[model samples]
Target: MCLISFYLIFVFSMTLFIFGIYFILYDYSLFIEWEVVSMNSLSIVMTLLFDWMSFIFMSFVLMISSLVIYYSKEYMFHDYKINRFIMLVLMFVGSMMLLIISPNLISILLGWDGLGLISYCLVIYFQNVKSYNAGMLTVLSNRIGDVALLLSIAWMLNYGSWNYIFYLEFMKNYSEMMIVGVLILMASLTKSAQIPFSSWLPAAMAAPTPVSALVHSSTLVTAGVYLMIRFNLLLYNSWLSSLLLILSSLTMFMSGLGANYEFDLKKIIALSTLSQLGLMMSILSIGYSKLAFFHLLTHALFKALLFMCAGAIIHNMNNNQDIRLMGSLSLLMPLTSTCFNVANLALCGMPFLAGFYSKDLILESVLFSYVNFFTFLLFFLSTGLTVCYSFRLVFYSMTGEFNFSPLNLLNNESWIMLSSMLSLLYLSIIFGSILNWLIFSSPILILLPIYLKLFTLFVCFLGGLMGYMISNVSIYFYNKSLHYYNLSSFFGLMWFMPYISTYGVINNYLMMGQLSFKLFDQGWSEYFGGQNLYFLMKYNSQLNQVLQNNNLKIYLLSFVFIVVILFMFL
Candidate 1:
């Protein structure tokens, strides 16, 4: 069943890729609109936008998802609930597709909400406490973005249509539309796991590897980037763009730094995804949505492959995800190791690989753009940190002595998994060049001084060296992290972002909730509401019982008191 699904989706992906190229060649777009309901000059419409970007992005998404499904057939073969897993994955893909094609805010919301809900389901698929907590974090973080989208949708009602694509041009002139733009930026930031929302991306790794390959790579996280790309016009000449620039640059730097300190194999990759997302968002914020989209596609190709390789390794190693316990995998699983290294190098933007074309262009563009020194430093430093983490991961996992149980046999014997990875491996090597040629009509001319041009290479080399040095440190050596526990914890813990987003934001509220529970549910409300009513009813019944005890004295006294009160009032 999985193989058949893979083949069907693979063919569809190729078809869409061809159509996307043809559309790009002709600069063609197709917009289909259907009115769902009309109420007194206000019409609700469902719209589908078919353009080169959508076609190509959808193609990548479907392609990666299909490969992941095929790979999961082997990875999850022993699982009792593989069928349910497949269905959830399919639902996830469907939601992402809906998001890719929708231009209307309402339809986008449908797809957006679907992605969040389906992702939560996928994240908790393991049925464990950790998965459940991760799922809650993932869903709650995304819900903030959902609220932003809903509010933006509501704001769009002023223009009498939910098709926000139409309003992009006019948004720059109207001050009110700036609110919508800011709201959209907020939505995208949360969706893309920028800054405060970043903790969930790594936490979400409690999910199965296949879900990570699909969700973290092409579909769920990129939804925000795609949305911002679609609404690029709203960002032009807007202060929101600068805000996006600063925030995204910081996100890029932070995630890259976090990746360096991380030891979890999947989490290292997850943080890399977060860093790349920040890169895409930063480029998009600088008014080069095309560059951002370009990076998005290229990133999807390599990042998905990287996760698949990690999954293959994990599946072979009894599901141990600690890099410290993995070593010399290249000797046992050469093909998987080769693929893993390729993906890692591609992630580092090693020259001429898939990432280089897009990443290089983005860096050059940033250098060319008139931005403050801080943005400039963050961009280059983040690029370097990316290389650092990639090298560190390789050193720990592929170069050292075998650290696992010696009796365990690890090999790339699963043809099913290897075949799917090989497909992406080829794409990761060549897709960037193909995309570069097809997406741009004329070559982008980047004129910079020789020193400036070579600066990126220098940073990458320095980062690689630093990564090697850090990873090469003997375990017997003085542990800096142990000595400076708080500092290391802060960096290793993503600058305490998880705590800030989860505990920091909610700690006070939770305390308030506890207080409310005590004061209201268990205290004042309990006493004044149910308890007070119960006591009043009890006292009244007791008084009535006493009055009706058949005591002539009590009855006579009550009647005389009532008669005297009436006489006094009269």
Candidate 2:
């Protein structure tokens, strides 16, 4: 009965998402840069909001929700609490749906706030110590981001207008409003877990794999990309855009490094999610709206598919997810292997894969951007690094020798899981090619020089190759070599964990010692013998004590007398 209800809800919900999302997609051109003009005194000028770009984001929201339901069906089947899980997932999906379609600042805030609310519950779903910590961490980390966004919104409404369209168009004339844009970008950084705001994501891996996958691909991380995508117009000027490029590149590098450091499979995926979002943002920084949105959709397909497989891998293995424990199961889990391999290649951006399309687009975006050769070079190096990590993830997690013997896990997924993976695989491949052909050839497009596109492709392919080669070395040995070298330390050169998470970074014993030192500093003369001096200084000897004691009343009487004297003079 539980199984039947789960299936029913999934089928019905997904049907709605598919129809709703695609209908919006089919009529994307119909969406205009809407403006709420003069009637609302703040809307003095034309605004560029609620366009095809926003519509594209809505489509992604739909795709992720539909795919997640499919993943949850197989994942949630037999548990007695399955009903509750399904309910949360449904509500979560609905919130995201509302988030993307939201028309105004209030609507966007509703969606943005909904992300936190549902995500908080979802993270703590297990009610374990670790899960609770993750949920709390998620909230604490996001608060800073939330503040920045709220302030940004307030500034815009007070100055420009309440309308999102107006905010974008008006920001150019009113340069001060860019502060608001920056604040909103900060919120995006927190939501997407970009660097300096990036600590909560690895902790968030404590959620169920499906939740992690959904968070990474669709709702959580995409908020940043969605913000950047939404403000593609406002993110003008080399200086502001360059700052974004640097931040995005920083996140891309550091997150990939973190992915490399983690042995836990889920962390690898989580960090990869961060890295991919960085690339997406970087692409947006370069003003390739069409390419950015295109990659965003393809990224949703493959990243979610990979996460679904990770969830499946854990489920089938009695929840053991240490990739080091997994080995070559090419034969034992043929179905898992086949589906996972395709997803893995897509993740690594092997040619013709979904990732390949988007990754190449990012390179193109950088190449075509206003930044000179150094920015281009810096972005290229980062792309290569991304390819390295993406492939390393695939090679380390999926393509190794079998460590534990295979259990009699259900090798075949239920209809939901199979359908989602299959559909994603289909979309990941076809989506880019169709876009490549149609968009480039559009009568409107002054297409990019062929040489530039070819160069970007070459760079992407070379990076993929380098990463793949490195991963082929034995996993244990590879880890040992990297550990001895301390590769991650390079990225952390400028970052000190103690400064950001003072209590969190220190060991308990060290923390106690630090606390003692702080207390001592506040207590002046603790070590300087001030306490001993205070005790040594006696205020009264026998004669002096008696004199002072007798004089106390006299002193009060004298003071009163002096007051009377002064008053008489007045």
Candidate closest to the true structure, highest lDDT: 1
Error of 1 at 505 (Å): 2.1
Question: What overall lDDT goes with each candidate model?
Answer: 0.91, 0.68
User: What lDDT tens digits, residue by residue, belong to model 2 across residues 418-456?
Assistant: 777777777767766655544443533334888876776
RMSD to the true structure for each prediction, in A, is: 4.0, 8.4
User: TM-score for model 2?
Assistant: 0.76
lDDT comparing candidate 1 with the true structure = 0.91
lDDT of 1 at 107: 86
Candidate 1 error regions (>4 Å)? 37-43, 474-476, 526-570
For model 1, how does the per-residue alpha-carbon lDDT over 1-570 read when each residue is reduced to its tens digit?
788889999999999999999999999999998888999987777899999999999999999999999999999999988888998999989989999999888889999999999999999998899999999999999999999998998898889888888888898888777889989988999999998789899999999999999998899999999999998888888888898888889888998988888889999999999999999998898989899999999999999999999999998888899998999999999999999999999999899999999999999999999888999999999999999999999999998699999988998958999999999999999999999999999999999999989988899999999889888873436656677778878888888998888888767778989999988888877988999999999999999888779988988898999999999999
- Compute each candidate's TM-score over C-alphas: 0.92, 0.76
